[model samples]
Target: MNERSLVFFVIVLLCAGFMALSSFEMVQDYIKPASGRSVILNHLMKLTVALVFFVVFLYTDHRMLFSRPVIVGGYVLSIALLVVVLILPGGETRTHRWMNLGYFSFQPSELVKIYTILFLAWYVEKNQLFMKRLFRGFLKPLLLVSPFLFLILVEPDFSTFALLFLTVMLTLYVAETRGVYVLTFFSIALIFFVYTYRMGMLNNILRSYQIERLVSYLKGNVSEQVMRAVEAIRSGGTVGKGMVLGEEKLFVPVVTSDFILAIVGEELGYIGLGVILFSFYGLVHSLVKVVSRMQPIPSVKTFISGFAILIMLQVMVNVGVVSGIFPVTGVTLPLVSYGGSSLLATMIGFGIVGNMILESERE
Candidate 1:
């Protein structure tokens, strides 16, 4: 692996360690709603799955993903799962984001995120010459990505949708698609949004809670959950309440998952938050540095850019939500969140990234 990638790997492990320790602290306090062996086993499973994926992708030939059939099949399979996930019960009707596997739930959206990145990178690299064309280049890829996106939005996963949008947009931008096409595309999207609202499509599509969150954000008020997050952050002051000493940890709902950043802020204070943010920043910075320093193929450079942006965007979204900067999103803090699917997906992303560097070194 390249020097930059190796440094990032170390940072990822450190972040994972910090998250694991913090999660255990929550477990001891009984902050999570679930109980018994499930929680413990689930945590163990994330680590186990992460190890397996990272090892395979890191050591093995990364070229498997470049196979067009593999890319197309993976994309199709992920989309199919997204469709199936929607069919599964969410709470009242069917599940939105995950498929229950008895012992633990599997989030197909997580897998889709990685696949989307790979698909765009592969598609862009192959269609580089034709990319500047309007329909053949821009519109076709948009159409291809839209079905998966539509399914995700139908699942009402706004956060994941946001990530997907960024990944595709960054990929196109890196591919040097024309500014006019990008602008026209956004303009058309705005028109589509208006049409959807006019036809009551947006209303039917967006969930009640999602609408509430959006309204709440516009009005500068948030749900009680974020209120608790604000309180937790305030209580931590600077140096933190000292890990397990954080009395406020239990109050914030989903403190072990979505709002875990608040836990870090409250338990370890700004110092801990600094470490978390710094680690993410360093990784993103290193990826950017790698892209700048190393002369890789255009596709590889775009892959690095898109991948780094995905990490940076997710981190910002999660941190921004917990800190009350952005509207609430289901985005997790990557390796720092106690989520098996998210953790595994993140590992897959990094492992592929490392493999890209490995291939470059061989070249």
Candidate 2:
């Protein structure tokens, strides 16, 4: 690999290493009581899956794969998968976010985020002049996005839907779409949000337990879920409780996924949390640098900026949820969270970013 690719690979490896260590710590604390060897193996298997996907994505030709037809096909496939997920039985706590295949579960909404970015990029590149117009150019992208958004909401995966919406908005803004057009879109979204909530659409779409989780969060009741997360962070204190010493791991729901930040806060403490945040900031900085240097290719630059903002926004939202600054939305902590699909999707996104940087460098 070239120096740039090597640097990108190193960063990805560091992220994976951190997540694996956290997962191991959780397993030792929670699962070891019943079967230590089995717990270790399970965590190792997850780590292996993530690593394998990362390696595969690193070797793939991102530029060729992100072509218009492939991007559109990906969107169609993602929607079909989302439909399949909705039809599948035994989703986590009644949330239709995954399709279980005995050995593993796949979340189609994660893949939707990727295809949305690709499609928007292609759309803006082809309609650069039209993009300067207000409604004809700007609002038209929403027509394509609306169906995906509607499908996600129907699946009752509000958190992912929200993230996806925000990502598209950011992409449009960076693509130089009119600001007033975005404001108008936002107004419409707000109206939809109010209408959905008032008409009990969320309740009809989401499971009762899922609704309860959101209610508990909004009420600040500190449900068993929230308390466990708090205990985990508290245990970390200044330095940390040390790996595998966290008491909260056994009780924290989705400890390896949405709640992974709590484990990191507990095991690595405030300093470790700082380091994690710093690494994310550094990654965003690198993306911005790439954008600045690739001014000649405005389309690519816009895409990179949009992608970076979207990823960083998710990271920030995840941290906020864990820190109690925002209601828990079940959003994974990007690379730090467990799950094969999430890891693979995120790595693919980063690979595309790397490709943009490489293409800029070649020019």
> Please, what is the whole-model Cα lDDT of each candidate in the order they appear?
0.77, 0.72
Residue 72 displacement in candidate 2 (angstroms): 3.3
Residue-level error in angstroms, candidate 1, position 280:
0.8
Error of 1 at 54 (Å): 1.1
- lDDT tens digits, residue span 224-295, model 2: 666688888887888987765666656688777787767777777887777777777777777777677664
Residue pairs of candidate 1 with colliding backbone atoms: 88-94, 88-95, 89-94, 89-95, 90-94, 90-95
Give per-model TM-scores.
0.90, 0.87
Write candidate 1's Cα lDDT for 1-363 as tens digits: 346554665566446555545554655646445445555456767778787998788876656787888987998898889989988878773338889988778999888888887788788778888888887678888888888888988888877886888678767867777878887777887798778756767668788777678768868997788889888878988998765666676778887788876777777788877877777777887788777765556667777788888888888888788878888878887777778888888888778877777877788
Which segments of model 2 are wrong by more than 4 Å? Answer: 1-32, 35-63, 90-92, 199-201
Stretch of 10 with least lDDT, candidate 2: 34-43
What value does the lDDT take at residue 228 in candidate 2? 81
How large is the C-alpha RMSD of every model relative to the true structure?
2.7, 3.3
Q: Which candidate wins on TM-score?
A: 1
